[model samples]
Target: MKNFKIIVLAKQVPDTRNVGKDAMKEDGTVNRAVLPAIFNPEDLNALEQALRIKDKYPGSTVTLLTMGPPRAAEIIREGLYRGADNGYLLTDRAFAGSDTLATSYALSRAIMKIGDFDFILAGRQAIDGDTAQVGPQVAEKLGVPQVTYAEEIVDIKKNKAVVRRRLEKGVETVESVFPLLITVTGTAPACRPRNAKLIMKYKRATTISERQNVSEDYIFMYDDRPFLNLPEWNVGDIEAEPERLGLSGSPTKVKKVENVVFQAKEAKVLEADNQSIEWLMKELISNHTLG
Candidate 1:
């Protein structure tokens, strides 16, 4: 079997699901500093798919590419602990406040720099901005075919990939050739746990910016093991146009943000019986909560 070069697009996003009082700023923007950062959930699914491919094709390599703050290198290390061969962090102040379109452009440029990847895998959407546009937008910018809502990469033959996609009402299978982009969905299998050995090996992985803060004693380890240095690229490194970056390139604007709180007025207790279940379902359907 021919080994493949796969790039997994990942992200470090604010944990919006567990929002607190300090989640938003006075200017209607998210207060990411106050919120906990985590690996995007769907992106983990994408990583699992890439790792599966690498496992099936022994010589294949899984590389992770993420765009975020310098601290985002944490995700790269997380990917390394979970079977990725190497990873890159696209970090720079120039990428701040980027909308999906601008974000995709930056990622596309980075991918071009990496070069020769057979596939690009990313999450269908990010929790921070539930817009499922980045993956497809990156594909469009790179001029590659894209498959969204992918649940599984069923097989590969003759440089073609067979992918199973999840749909609202059903599932569909499609085939596409190499140099394709796929957006994995949460319905896919969860990512495997971090390997103990891999964790120990990659625990010291750090990008240049991160290394700068390290104590002098541990600095030599990074130079000794080059793999411990995760590549961190900025706008200049990727040769991106200055005007088409950050807020300058982002056209989307949020006019207002309102915090909503829901309170139950009443509650009813019922036995865990078939009749109760049927009544609950009927009530939910009647209220348009379920159908």
Candidate 2:
């Protein structure tokens, strides 16, 4: 089997499931500090698919890519624990406050900088944005074929990948040529648990900035082992235009955000008989709730 080089795009997002009263700011933007940061759920599934490919093909490598704050380095370490070979963190204040378009543009430039990859895999969408546009946008930017909502990557051969995409009604199977991008859905297999040995080996992995802030005791250790240093790329590190990154690159802006709540005001108890059913149907039709 050809040794495949796969890149998995992951994200560190606020744990929206445990939202609190302070989850949103007065300006209608999310207050990320109040929420715990976690690996995006669907991205984990994408990592699993990449790991599976690595396991199937000897000498294959799985690398992760993520763009966020300095703390986002945690995403890379998490991927290391879950069998990824290595990862890069794209961090810089210049890349902050990016919408989906800007985010994808930065990611594409980073991808180009890394170069030479058989596949680029990512989640269908980030939980924070839920736009589901980055993966396709990256594919377009790179001029590669893309498959979204992928439940499984069935096979890869002859520079073509067979993928199974999950659909609302059923599942679809499609073939995409190499240098393609795939966005896995939550329906894909869950990521494997962290490996104890891998954790022990990579627990000390840190970026240049992170290392500077910490104790210097491990400086010699990491210097001796270059792989222990996770790559961190800033705006200047990639060939991205300044105007096409961060807020400037973003074409969309949030004018306002609203909170919506649904409540039931009334309920009617009815028998499980034909007459009750007919009456319920009539009421629904009359109210235009059913067409």
Candidate 3:
């Protein structure tokens, strides 16, 4: 069997599901500093799929790639505990205010710098953007086939990947040749928890920026163990064009944000009887609230 080189695209996004009144800033931008940052949930599913493939083939490697601020290195360290071989943190001031298009452009260029890979897996959509465009955009930028909403990767045979896709109405299976991108869906299996041994081994893994700010305790460890040094790439490192990065590259702009609060106008208390239940059903049908 051929040893596969799989790259999982993960993101450290604000936990939007627990958004509060202050989640958005006055200017309509997200208040990322106030929100709790976490590993994108669907991206965890993508990691699980990649790890499964690694288990099937000996010598296979699973590397994570995430684009965010210096703090985003947390996602890489999280992946290490979950069985990824290594990871790259793409960070720079130029990538600060990027939209989906610019984000994908930088990611595609970074992937190119990493050289050959059999698969690029990503989440179907990020909780922050929720646009579900980055993975397909990356595929288009790389000129490769893409499979979105993938629930599971069935198998790889003859350099082709069979993937099961989850749709609104039903499921569909599709196949794509090697060197393609796939975005996994939330319906896929949940990622395995961190291993105790892996945590002990990689607890001190730090990027160059992190290492510089930390105490002198791990200075000797960096020289003795190269694997403990996580890779951090800037715009210059990936050779991305300045014009196509950050706010300049982003075409989509938010106009305004409106907060809408819903309140119940009225309520009715009914006896727990068959007649009351029948009347409630009829009222709901008439109001088109149910059918």
Candidate 4:
């Protein structure tokens, strides 16, 4: 089989586990610093699946792609240490607070610019937004077949692929042509640990400011280290339609983000005695809390 060019979409999101009231901005945007930064869970799973494919296909390549601030480059280097051949950091101030539509537009154009892609893989949803639109939207923009909520590969060929997809009740098998986009679900395996040698070699790979932080050891480890830095792309990187590349390109807008505070509701006690229990059951049934 010929080598395949696979692109895996990854994301870095705020660590919600550490989120506090200060973690949100006045406009409801996440204060990424207040919350720790971490890779999107499902996206890491997607990377794992792509790496598995590379292991099976000799000479195949897995290229990780992500859209976020420049600091997002950390995970790009991390992906390389974990077996990805290359990565692209889509960074631009214009892309701030982008909904899924804007994100997909930027990604689709970048993928086209990267060229020679036989398959595109993404997590079914991003932890930060939880919107699964980007995967299918990229497919639509690229005019290729897509299989979403993919769980397993049942069959593979040079010109086509067949996969099992997750559904509410059960799974369904779907087939699509090459150059297809796949949105993977958490049902897939997790990302494996990085190779020891690659970690030693590429962990120093970094973007601009990252170099400023730990320059001598990490960024200047080798005479040729600078060559590996990812080329950060802005709105100018691709021939993207202006209206489709940023806030203007997005149709959806967030109205508000309420901070939900849980409070206990008044409850009536149910006695353990059968007669009282039966009466309580009847009352609960009448109130629709029980049947």
Clashing pairs in 1: none
- Which runs of model 1 end up more than 4 angstroms from their true locations? 22-30, 261-291
Q: How would you encode candidate 1's per-residue C-alpha lDDT over 1-291 as one tens digit per residue?
A: 689999999999899999877777776567778888899999999999999999999999999999998999999999999999999999998898899989999999999999899999999999988999999999999999999999999999897999999999999999998799999999999999999999999999999898888899999898799999999999999999978888899889766777554886777889999999999999999999986
Clashes of 4: 1
When 1 and 4 are scored with lDDT, the better candidate is 1
The parts of candidate 4 lying over 4 Å away from their true place are: 17-31, 213-223, 261-264, 268-291
Report lDDT (Cα) of residue 269, candidate 1: 88
lDDT of each residue in 114-228, candidate 4, tens digit only: 9988889999987777888889998998998899998876667868888889987999998888888999899888889888988877776776556567646544453466547
Candidate 3 C-alpha error for residue 271, in Å: 9.1
Model 2, position 112, has a per-residue lDDT of 94
Error of 3 at 124 (Å): 0.5
The lDDT of each candidate is: 0.94, 0.93, 0.94, 0.83
Score candidate 2 by TM-score against the native: 0.89
RMSD of each: 4.8, 3.7, 3.2, 3.4
Please give the lDDT score at residue 146 for candidate 3.
97
Error of 3 at 6 (Å): 0.4
Instruction: Name model 2 segments beyond 4 Å from true.
Output: 22-29, 261-291
Residues 1-291 of candidate 3 have per-residue lDDT tens digits of: 788999999999999999887877776666778899999999999999999999998799999999999989999999999999999999999998899999999999999999899999999999988999999999999999999999999999987999999999999999989899999999999999999999999999999999988788769999998889999999999999989989999998766766554886777889999999999999999999997
